[model samples]
Target: MLRYSAFSRDPAGGNPAGVVLDARGLDEREMLAVAAEVGFSETAFLVPADGGFDVRFFSPRAEVSFCGHATIASAVAHAERHGAGGLRYRTAAGDVDVVTARDEDGSWRATLTSVPPVVRDLAPQDLDALLAALRWSAQDLDPALPARTAYAGAWHPVVAVRSRQRLADLEHDVAALERLAAARGWTTVDLVWRQDATTFHARNPFPAGGVVEDPATGAAAAALGGYLRAGGHVPLPARLTVLQGEDLGRPSTLHVAVPADPAAGVAVTGAAVAMP
Candidate 1:
């Protein structure tokens, strides 16, 4: 059976993730089929491991290295089963450590540390192709952030928009963008807008995953946090909130913390509630 939760929410706003607590007997084909059937942006499958759990993430179209929202959902599910605390996940990408706790309101929250991240500037031609796919002009992009490719567990093209309205009016050529992303091995086109010094708005276009958009993207957020920290855009020990899925009405909020250590992974925290 599959358990569903909209992470970073009280059963309402947030990205919906599917969690399979017992995924021992399933093979890769079975997992893919299950994810397709679930039809969420991603699904987390957990199997027994040494003192912790082995996890895998699958999109409707294919398997991914790691997925942030699904990870949060899985951790919360594990917490509900084993009691709220800390848990380590051995994922396809790498080892991810997560801590789960219950708030005063009895809501379960989970914080996950990402793998080491990196950011690189996108090639001009590639950026142009991506812009064509999204119907966004170079003028629409934010001058400060520029276009770059970032990675935590998966690769995503970070495109900062000048305004939230540009982010909200997302319309893209799916097949064309899918081909571009597949050729580049990119997971998603991370569209973002800086709302303030410590707040941002984001929209993720995930054509490669066969999803039109992601309401909340944990991996991309981790990458963005790393990028910002490395570029010195935000100060050390800063906690930034990423508001996403607002256009879709899911309205997910992702909290990310960046430390001074460049080698350290970003910390992403959010609540996950079981869907009825």
Candidate 2:
């Protein structure tokens, strides 16, 4: 297994992921064991398939349907060794297509096209429960953005706070949040503060995945793009930059592009660096 950090040029500045380049023979138990040993947020195991590869993501605690950072890290790692090109990833959520290219500065950037996204209203009870767990009042939320459940690859509650300080002061009941997430089939709670029309600050709580927070979550970024476009928060063909992990001292960036079509996949782009 190899270690790589996704969404940052520097290895220590992004979310770390374990990449098992060839995991043909490993079973579920062994994969879980390896993931636990690696102790990252998630690990990507690739098994060669006909068109591209079958990928499975395992967290330290359990298997998740999709993991954005691991996918980006794996694709960039693959590109570094094989060549920059398109890769079809067969994930549990769906078939995700990724393209990798080397920039002029010699950095490999990967863009993952998420599955068609969906945004739905947040149930009142669920929202109340979430607010209670975070010790946030309704006034702390952004009225323009509103609360909603978004799904691209994995489900996330996209909570837009009114202040960056509110987003930064992250204090939550981990067990309660984990229980709520597991019950709702949610992977993360995407807490965000819109800096401007095209820039945002985000922090993700991923207790269900056995992590306190995700430094850079491409899946949540894509979901946020879908939510913004669907709700007409941003204009069509919008390009937004999400700044994350600064509070944790592991800064990461996610570039999200939302097309005109609502049913189309959201594109998330970022760079990955091999970790020591």
Candidate 3:
């Protein structure tokens, strides 16, 4: 049976992720079909491993290297079965170490450390084509945080908008964006609006995955955190809050903590609740 869990909240909200606790017999096509049937942005399929678990992520359209929200959901589900603490996940991208615990508020929270991240500047022609597909002009972009392609476990284009309104009004040509993303092997387009140094708003366009928008994107948040830290955009040893899905009304909050170590992976923390 497929289990549904909403990460970063107590079931009522946060990003909903589908978890298949046992998926030993499923192939890629079966997994993809399951994910589509579940109807979440992504689903986690877990198989037994030596001391932990082997995890794979599948969106509606295809398999992905890694997915943060689904990771959080699966970890919490594992904790519920095996008791809460540290759980190691061997994912397609790499080995991800996750810690699950009960917070003071009695909520189950999980933090996942991503793989080493990289950021590359976007080409002018590519950026122009993306803008045309999204119907966004250069004037809507923020000057401080220029456009770039960022990757932690997956690749995403980081587009910083000057205002939240621009981010809220997300209407893009799905086929056009999908072609561009497929050509570049990008998972999603991270549209962001910085409310302040520590607070920001975000929206993610995921045409390649056959999803219009991702309510809460832990992968993109990790990439953004790494991008900001690498670029010296934020002070070291700082934590940032990303408010996402507000425009979509799902309203997810992602907490990102940046460390001083350059080689360290970004820490993304959130709570997951089981869906009834």
TM-score of each: 0.97, 0.99, 0.96
lDDT of 3 at 92: 85
Give stretches of model 3 more than 4 Å off: none
RMSD of 3: 1.2
TM-score of 3: 0.96
TM-score between candidate 2 and the true structure: 0.99
lDDT of 2 by residue, 1-276 (tens): 999999999998989999998999999999999999999999999998997999999999999999999999999999999999999999999999999999999999999999999999999999999999888999999999999999999999999999999998988989999999999999999999999999999999999879999999999999999999889999889999999999999999999999999889999999999998
The best-first sequence of candidates by TM-score reads 2, 1, 3
* Global Cα lDDT for candidate 1: 0.89
* Alpha-carbon shift of residue 197 in model 3 (angstroms): 0.6
Kindly indicate the candidate among 2 and 3 with the higher lDDT: 2
lDDT of 1 by residue, 196-250 (tens): 9999999998987899989899999999998888777898988999998889878
lDDT of 3 at 253: 83
Please list all clashing residue pairs in model 2, or write none if there are none: none
Q: Candidate 2, overall lDDT?
A: 0.95
Q: Model 3 residue 218 lDDT?
A: 91
TM-score of 1: 0.97
